[model samples]
Target: MTGVQKLENSKRNKIQAYDLAIHDWYQFILGYPPHLVRHYIEKFGVSKYDIVFDPFCGTGTTPVEALKNGISSYGLEANPIATFASKVKTYTDYDPDLLLEYLAYIRRSMESSYSNYGIVEPQADLFSYKARFCTIKVKDIINLTESQLQVIPKGFISPKPLLKVLIIKEIIRSIENKDARDFFLLALAKFIVKEAGNVRFGPEVGRTKPKSDIESIHSFTTIAEIMINDVQKTKLTGQAQIMQGDARSLDKYMTRELVRGINCVITSPPYPNEKDYTRSTRLESVLLDFIRNKRELRGIKENLLRSNSRNVFVSDNDSRYISSFSSITSIAQEVENRRLALNKTSGFERHYNKIILHYFGGLYRHLKTLRPYLARNCKLAYVVGDQMSFFRVLIPTAELLGEIAESLGYRIKEIELWRTRAATATKMQINENVLILEKK
Candidate 1:
C-alpha cells in the first residue's frame, strides 16, 4: 500500500502488529494484543544514561512499559483514575496465587457481607440496574449484611477500591466467557471517567478511550496470567514507575535519582478538548480516595491545558494564533476547502485550529519545563497528528517542538512517520505521525 493506502489499511486492522503501534483497544479492553510497552522499548532502545518519563502517563503505559526493560522511569498524570490504574499495572506482582489471594480475600468478606445490608440490602431498582450494567451478578452481592460491609477483611481493607474492583473481578474470575471479561475490564476502565463521573476523551485519539457508561460482552479470563506480561511479551529494556504530580512543576514529586541521567522524553499533554480530567475521574476519584472529597476536586476542571476552550487555559485573543494556521504546508487546508465545497458550517476548521495551537503551545511549554531535567544527548519522541481547520493546518507539532527545543538550546534530529493512520478510527483525522527530537 502507498503511504495513504497503508494508513487507510492500518486503521481497519488497528495497525497493532506494525512497528508504529504504541498500544491497542484489545490490550486496554481484552488483553488479546499483548502489551505495546515492551515493543516501544525495543524500538526506541534505552541506555544507562536514560531515565524516562511520560508526563501524561495514561494508565501508566509508559512506566509499566519502562519497567519490563528494567529502565528506571517516572510518570505524571493529572487524571486520578488513570493515574491509579497505571499504579495497579505497576504494583501487580505476578507471584503465584496473587490473584487467588485476592480472590480468597473477597470470598471471606462476601460471607460476612451477608449481614451488612441485612436481608433486604438492595434498593428496588438497584438490582435491576446493576444486573444490566455491571458484569458481576448484583443479586449475589446484595445479600451481604452491613456488618460484612463494615468489617472489611485484611485483603479488602482498603474498603474503598475493593468493592468497585470486586464488582468487576468477581465477574472476571467467575465468568466463563474470556472475551466478555476482557471487554468488560476495558469498558469499565474506559467508563471510569464517565462511570466515576470523570473526564471524557478529547478530539485527539491518543487521549485513551472515551467515557462510556455501557457494558460490553467481551471475556475476562487470563489471556496472559503473568503480571508485567506486557513487559516480557513485547521484549523491552526498562521498567515503569508511575508517580503523581503537576507537570508544570515536576520537581516537587520526582526524586533526584529518578530524574538524573535521563536520555529521552516522550509524552502528550492534554489538548484543549473540553475534557475535564477532574470530572472524568470524578467517580473513581471518590471511590478510590485519590482525592479527599468532591470539594477538593471542584477546581480541577480549571487545571486542564488551554487546548480546549472549556478550561481556563485560553485567552480571548487566542483566535490570533488560530488564524496563523493559514500559513501551514500541510494537508489540513484541503480539509477546509472540502468542507467549504460542501457548503458546511465548517466551524470545526477554526476550532480545530485553535485546539491545535493550544495543544502545541501547551506541549512547547511542557517541553521547556522538561529540558532542564534531561541528560545530555537525549532523544524526545512525540506521537501526534494534523487536524484540518479553517482552510489551514493548525500548529505543526514536529516543527513547533523543533522550534521550542532550538529556542531552549536543543537541536532538531529526526521527524519520521511512525505509523499510518487507521482508516476506521472515528476518533480523529488520519494524519497520525510521530516526532523525534534531541537536546543540544
Candidate 2:
C-alpha cells in the first residue's frame, strides 16, 4: 500500500521488449534481458560520473547496458568462455573499419573455396542444414587441409583464443542464408558447442537436452554452418567495455588507472548445491584450450559467487555459521561443518551445510568490501533465489545481505521479488529476486 511497496511491485513485472532485430554484430552467450538492464539504469539515474560494475559479470550484460547510456563501465568474471563472450559484447569501441574489411575478406575467402569445401556429404541428413543455410558449403570438415586454412590468417595478439575465435567466426559467417534477424544470430553465436562431439544446445527451458543429441551433429561442418549464419546475421548496437578478469582480485588484472569506483552491483551467484560454472563450460574450456582436461576445469574459483558452490575457502566467519548449525543438530551438521573446515581456503566439494554458510558469508564480504568503492547515493542490486537446504528455510540472501550492507554503512532500501523464467525441475530452475541497496 505504501510508495515503497508499489515501486517494488512494478519492478517485479515481466518486461516487454520492443524493436525488431536489426544489428549484425550483436551476439550473446548467456545474454541478459536488455529491458531489465535498461530498467536499472533508468530507475537509478546513472550518470557519467558514475561507473557500473558486475562482480559476477556473466557475459557482461550489466557493463554493456551501462556503456550504452554513456556511463563508463567495468566487469569482472572468471569463466573463460563467459569471459570471451562478454568481451565481444562490451567492446563497442571497436574499429568498424577493421570489422568491415574483415567481413569483406572473409566473404571473398569463403566464396573462393565454395566447390572445394562443398563435397560429398558424409551424412545426408546434415546436408539439409547446410543447403538450407548456404549456396556453397563444406559438407565434410575432416577433408579440409591445413593449406586451405592458411588463407584465413591467425595472430590476433592472443595465443590460442584467437584461433578459437577465427574458427567460430568463419564457420558462422560462411553459412548464413537468412535475412539476419537478431534472435537467429544470438542463437547461433551462442552455439559454439554445435560442432563439438559432446556439445548440445540444451532445452529452451532450464537447459536440459540429451547428451546424445549434442554428440549427433557435433562435427566441423555442422558447427561451422550454424555459427557462420549466426554471426553473419547478428546485429549489435550500443556502447560497452567488457574486460575479462577476476572480481575477487580486480587489482591484479586492472592497472592503477582502469579500475573505477562502482555505482551499482547486480549478480546471481551459482546455487549453493548446484553445478559449477567451470564444469558447465567444460566444452568451451577444452575446445578453446583454456583448461587442459575436466579435472583441470574443476574448482576454477574466479568469480563464481561464494554462496553457490561448495568450492569456497573456509574462513573464520564460515566456522561461526557451522558452529551455529552444529549447536542445533548433530550428524548432518557435523558432516557439513567438517566439509566447510576441510576446504579452509576456497574451492571445495559441494557441501549442503557449508554452501549455506558460504553463500551468506561470501556475499557479506563482497558487499562490505564495496562500501569504500561505491559513489555517494549509489544503488546496489542482487538477483537471488533461495532454496530449502536440509529442511531448514534459508532466505539469508536478502536478510543477511541487508545486515552486511548496513554494517558497511549502506542503506538497505528494498528487496524486490521479480518473478523470473525458470524450469520445472528444482535444480535448473531460474528464481531471480532483486535486492536493492543504497549508499548513504
Candidate 3:
C-alpha cells in the first residue's frame, strides 16, 4: 500500500512493531508515532545533509527516528526525565556487550542484597498474576526523602513496589560507568511505570489497585535486554543533539553552528488541555530523582507552555504576546463567560480562560524565537490536536498555530488531517492535525 493509504488505514498514534527499537525504550503517553516522523521526512524530501529539529522533543521520538533514517537531528525538551530519556534513546555509542556485563553485575548485586536481607526473590508468576502475595514490609526498605515522597502523588505507587524500585535504583546507580548507569536507570524507569507502580494511563495518568510486590529485578533485566538488543542493531550514520530547556526560548540552547542550520522540523508540542503532562511521569520522575522537590517541579513547569491551569502563574505575560489577535481573545472571553455562567468559582476554574491565551502566546513566542534558526524555506510540521477541554469550548489548535506561524513570517503549506480523537470532556470527536509550514 502507498504511504498515504497506509496512514489512512492504520492507527496513527500506535508505535508499530517495526518502529519499536529505541522508541519503545521510553515514550510519552501521548507522543506521536515514529512512522509519522518518517511520513514527514519523506514528504519534505529530507536527507542526511538536512537537520530535523523537534523543539518540544518529548522522549526523543523525532530525533530517534531521524537518526535511524541516517538524518542528523536536534531536540529541545523542558521535562528533565524526558530529556534524560531522549539523550539515552538517541545515544548509539554504548557497547551492547558491556551493557550485558553491567546487567549481570546488577543482577548479582540484587540477588546478594535480597539474600542478605532474608527476603525471598519475587517469583515471576507473582508478577504475572498481579498478586499482592509478598510479605515484604515497607518499613524494612530504603526510603526516599520526605521532599521526594511529597512530590509523588498519593497512591500512585504503593510502599512495597516503591521499595523494590528504590532498591533496584540504588544498585543501578552503583554502576561505575555513567553510560551503563543511565541505560540501566532508563530500564528501571520503564519498570517503575509499567511494572512496579500503581500508575496506569488511559490517556491520563491515574492510579490502579496497588500491587504488594513485583518481580522488580527480573522485569528490569528484561527491559534492559530489550534496550541492549536495540543498541546492538543500531547503525548510526548521523548525529543527534538533545537539550533540556524551554522550547519558548530555544535559542538559548542553540550553539553558533546550529544558527539557521535546521532544515526540517517535526514535533508534537503539548496540546491546550487540562492534562498536566507532568503527572503522567511523576512516579518515575520523583523515584529517578529528575524532580526532587516542589520547588524544582514548579521550575520545570514554568519552562513549559502554559497550556493548563496547573502550570499557569500570576506572573505569566505570554498572553500579552498575542493580545492583538481578536480570534484568540474572543475564545478566551467565551471561555470565561462559560465558566461564569456555570458558576465555576474555583481557582483553577478562574485560570481556564488564561490558559487559552497563554498557550497560543507561548507558541507565538516559540515560533518567533525559532525564526532565525531555520534555514531558508525549511519545512515544518506541528502535530497538534483540537481541544474542548475547558467548559467544552473548542480550541482549534492547529489552525491557531498556523496563523501564529504565518504572523512570524512562516508560510502555511497545509493543515493536513493526521487523526481524530475523542474529547475527554465532551466525548465528541476532535480533529488532530499537522500544521505544515515553510520559512519565508
How accurate locally, in lDDT, is each candidate?
0.46, 0.48, 0.87
Candidate 3 lDDT over 72-173, as tens digits, reads 899999999999999999887899888888877777666655655565765522233221122223454457889988988999887667766777777777
Decide which is better by TM-score, 2 or 3.
3
Number of the top candidate by lDDT? Answer: 3
Ranking by lDDT: 3, 2, 1
Instruction: Give the runs in model 3 whose Cα sits over 4 Å from its true position.
Output: 1-5, 8-10, 124-142
Residue-level lDDT of model 2, residues 396-431, one tens digit each, is: 345555665676688888877655444434344444
Assess candidate 1 and give its lDDT: 0.46
Better of 1 and 3 by TM-score: 3
Clashing pairs in 3: none
Tell me how many clashing residue pairs each candidate has: 52, 18, 0
Q: Native-vs-model 3 lDDT?
A: 0.87
User: What TM-score would every model get versus the actual structure?
Assistant: 0.59, 0.63, 0.95
